[model samples]
Target: MSTVFVVGSLNIDQNIRVRSLPRAGETVRGSDATFSPGGKGGNQAVAAARAGATVKFTGAVGDDAHGRRILEVLSEASIDAGHVRVSGTAATGTAVIAVDDHGENQIIVSPGANSGITAADVDAGLAAVQAGDVLVLQLEIPTALVRQAARTAKGRGAFVILNAAPAPRQIDGLLDDVDLLVVNEQEIQVLAGLAGMPGNHRDLVQALPPALGPAIVCTAGAEGSFTVLDGSLVHVPAATVAARDTTGAGDTFVGYLAASLAGSHRDLPAAMIHATRASAIAVTRTGAMESIPWAHEIPASAPKPATPDPATPNTASPNTALSSPVVPN
Candidate 1:
C-alpha cells in the first residue's frame, strides 16, 4: 500500500444532542453531551488508515489530555503520529457541535494549537513524499503553511488532494499549485463561484472549468458528486440513506477517495463511487473518526465500462500519482 501524508488539524470534539437546533440568539437544551476525536485532517487520516492506506499525520496539539487522546485514536487506527507536534503555545483545537434529532448539525471551531503549524513543520511532515505518495490536506491549518505544503509536496512528486472546508475569505492565487480541488455544495460556490443549486449537480458540472488547471470535485449530499477532469465531466450519484449524524461524512468520502486512488488501479469515477459508498456508511453512525468506514465495509467495485471515462487512468490513477501541482491544503 502507498503511504498517505495527512497534514492537518487534530481537535477534541464536544458533541451535544439536541431535540432541535437553536436559532440566532436562542438557547436550547441539549442532552447526551460527549467528547470525541475530530478535526477534518484527523478524521480524514483515520479514514485513510481504515481504507487500507498507511497514513502519516502531521499537526499540532496542546500538551494536554485531549491531545493525548487524539494521538491515541490515531495510533489505534495504525496511523503514524511521529510528525505530530506537542505544542505548549496553545491548547488542542476544539469544536463545539450540536446535532439535532434530524441529524442536521451546527458547529463552532476554536483553532487553538491548530494555528501553530508553520512552514518548517510542513517541510518536516512531508519529507517522505519523494516517492509517489498521497498527500491529503484541509483548511484547518494556516493558509501560508497550506500553500507551502502544496508547493513542497508537489515538488516531491506526491499527489495532493485538498479539501477546502470552511471556505477561506481570500482565494487569490492559492490554488495555483493544486492538482485536485475537493469542495462541497456551498464551498464550490464560494471558491469556484459555481453555485450548485441544492438538489441539482448538473449546474456545477456545466459551470466547472480547469480555471486553475486542476480537476475539481464538488460533493452534494444525496444529490451526488460532480467532477471535471481530463477535459470531461462525470457525475456519480450518491446512495440514499437515512442519516443519523452527518458530521464527518465528507471527511470519510475524501479519505476513502484518496485511498482508492493512491496506489490502486481504481479510476477516478470508480474511486468516487467507492468514496460515496463509504460516506453513506458514515452517516449512519455518529462521531468523526469513529464514524469512518473500513476497507472491508466497502463493497467490491462494479465492472469497468466497455469504454472507460477519459478521466479514468490509463496507466496510473491521478490519485495514485499526481505530477507536481496540488490542490490547496
Candidate 2:
C-alpha cells in the first residue's frame, strides 16, 4: 500500500453539549462538556489510518500537555508522528465547540502552534514521501507551508490531494500543483464568488479556473457529492443517515478518499463511493476521531435498494450511482 503524508494542524477540541446554541447575549445552560483530540489534519490522518493507509503526520504542537496528548493519540491510531514538531513559544491549537440536542455544532478555532508551521517543516516532512505516495493537505496551517508541501509532493511524483477547508480568500498559486481540490459547497462559493443561489454541478465546475487542475470535487452534505475530472462530470450520492455530530465528516470523507486513491483502486468514482460510505458512518456517532469507523468495521453488505431511511441511518450502502448536490459536513 502507498503511504499518505498529512501536513496540517493538531488541536484539542473542547466540546459542550447544550439544549441549544446561545443567542446574541442570552446564555443557555449547557448539559455537559468533553475534550477530545481533533484538528483537520489530525482528524484526516486518523481517518486515513483507520481506513487502512500507512499515514504520516507533519504539523506543530506546543510544549504543553495538550501537545503531548495529541502525539499520544496519534500514536494510538498508528499514525507516524516522527515529523511532528514542538513549538516553545506557542501553545497547542484548540477548538471550542458547541453541540445542540440535534447534533448540530458551532466551532471556533485558535491556530496557536499550528500557525507556526513553516516551509522548513514541510521540507522535513518530505523526507518520507516517495513517488506514487499520497500527500493530503488542508488550509488550517500556514498557506506558504501548504504550498511548499504540495509543490514538493508534486515534484516527487506523488499525488497531491488538497482539502481546502476554512477556505481563504486567496490560496497563493498552490492549486496548480494540486492533483485534487476537495472542497464543499460553501467553500466553492467562497472561492468562486458566485451568487448565493445553488448551482448545477457543471456550472460550478466551469466556474473554477482552468489552470488550477483537472479535477474539482464539490461535496454536498445529505444531497451527495459532485466531481469534475478529465472533462467528465460525476455525481456521487451520499449514504443517507441520521447525523449525530457532523464534525469531522468532511475530514473522514477526504481521508477515506485519499486512502482509496492511494490503494489499489485508482478509479476516482470508486474512491468517492468508498469515502461517502465512510463519512456516512462517521455521522451516526459523536465526536471527531472517536466517530470514525475502521475499514473492517464498515458493514460488509451493501445498502438496500430502497430509498434511505432517515430514522435509521446506515453508512454502508451498495449502490454505486453518482448523483446529488455538493454539501460538505
Candidate 3:
C-alpha cells in the first residue's frame, strides 16, 4: 500500500446542536455544546487511518491545551505526526460549529495556528515522498505552501488530491500540480460565474475547459456526486441513511477515498463507492473526527480496475474542473 501524506489545518471544534440554522441577525436555542479535535487535515488523517491506510500528517497547532489534545488524537490514530508543529506565537485554531437537527451545519473558523505553517514545514513533511504515494491537501493552510508541496509531490511521482474547501476564488495555476480536484456544491457554485458558459451543473462540469486539468468530482449532498471520465460525466449515488450531524463527513470521505486509491485495490470509481459508504456512516454519527467510521464498518466495493483519473488534461483553469470528496466523484 502507498503511504498517504496529508497537509492542512488542525483545530478544536466546538459543536452545538440547534433546531435550525439561525438566519443573519437571529438567535436560536440549542443543545449542550461539545468540543473535540477536528480541522479538515486532522479529520481526514484520522479517516485514512481508520480506513486502513498508513498515514503521515503535516499541520500546525498552538502550544496550548488544544494543541496537546490534537496531538493526543493523532497519537491514538497511529498517524505519523512528526511533522506537526507547535506554533510559538499563535493559539491553537478553533471552529464554532452549529449543526441543525436536519444535520446541516455552519461553521466559523479562526485560522489561528493553522495559518502558521511554513514552507520549510511543508518540505520536511514530504521529505520522504516517493513515486506512487498519495498526497492529500486542503485549503485550511497557506495556498502557496500547498502549491509547493503539490508540485514537489508531483515531481516525485506522487498522486495529488486537492480538497478545495472554503473554495478559493481562483484556482488557475494551483491546479497544475494536482491530479484531482474536489469540491462541494456550494464551492462549485463559486466557480460557476467564471465558466459563464454553462447549462446545469453536469453541463458545467462537462464543459469545463481542458486547461483546468483532468478529473473533477462534485459532491451534491443527498443528491450524490458526479465526475468527468473520458470527457463524459459519470454519476455516483449516495448511500441511504438518516444523518445526525454532518460535520466530519467530507473529511471522512476524502480520507477513505485517498486510502482506497492508494491501496490500488480498485479504481477511482470503485473507490468513490467505497468512500461514499464511509461518509454515509459518518453522517449518522456526530462531531468531526469522532464521526469518521472504521474500515470494518464500511463494506468495500468490489475491485473495478480502470485508468487513473489524472491522465487526460494538463493545465488547471478557473474556466474548468472540480469535485468534493464527500459524495461520488
> Top model by TM-score, which number?
3
Clashing pairs in 1: 177-326, 178-326, 178-327, 179-326, 179-327
Alpha-carbon lDDT, every model: 0.79, 0.80, 0.82
1-329 per-residue lDDT for model 3 (tens digits):
88999999999999999999999999999888899999999999999999999999999999999999999999998999999999989999999999998999999999999888999999999999998888999988888988999999989988889888978877767778888777788776666665455446555555543646646677778866667654545567787889999998988889998998778573666677788889999999989998898899886553233232343352333322223232222
TM per candidate: 0.88, 0.87, 0.89
Error of 1 at 310 (Å): 15
Error of 2 at 52 (Å): 0.5
- Residue-by-residue lDDT tens digits, candidate 1, 1-329: 56889999999999999989999999999987899999999999999899898999989999999999999999999999998999987999999999999888999999999999887888898888864677888998998888888888888777778898888677766676666778887777776553323333344443443344456778988767877443345667778778999999999999988887675554667677878889988999998889998889876753222222454433322331222222212
Better of 1 and 3 by TM-score: 3
Query: Which run of 10 residues does model 2 get worst, by summed lDDT?
Result: 320-329
TM value for model 3: 0.89
**lDDT, candidate 2, 1-329, per-residue tens:** 78989999999889888888888898988857788889999999999999999999999999999899889989988999988989999999999888888777888999999988878878988887788798999999888888889889888878888898988777558686887788888787776653343455445654463534435778988768766533345567778788888888999999998888888767777677888889999989888878888999876654332232343223222122122211111
Residue 73 accuracy (lDDT) in model 1: 91
Candidate 2 residue runs with Cα over 4 Å from true position: 23-26, 194-202, 209-211, 302-329
What residue pairs clash in candidate 2, if any at all? Answer: 219-326, 219-327, 220-326, 220-327, 221-327, 235-322, 235-323, 303-317, 303-318
Q: Give me the runs in candidate 1 sitting further than 4 Å from their true place.
A: 194-201, 229-231, 301-329
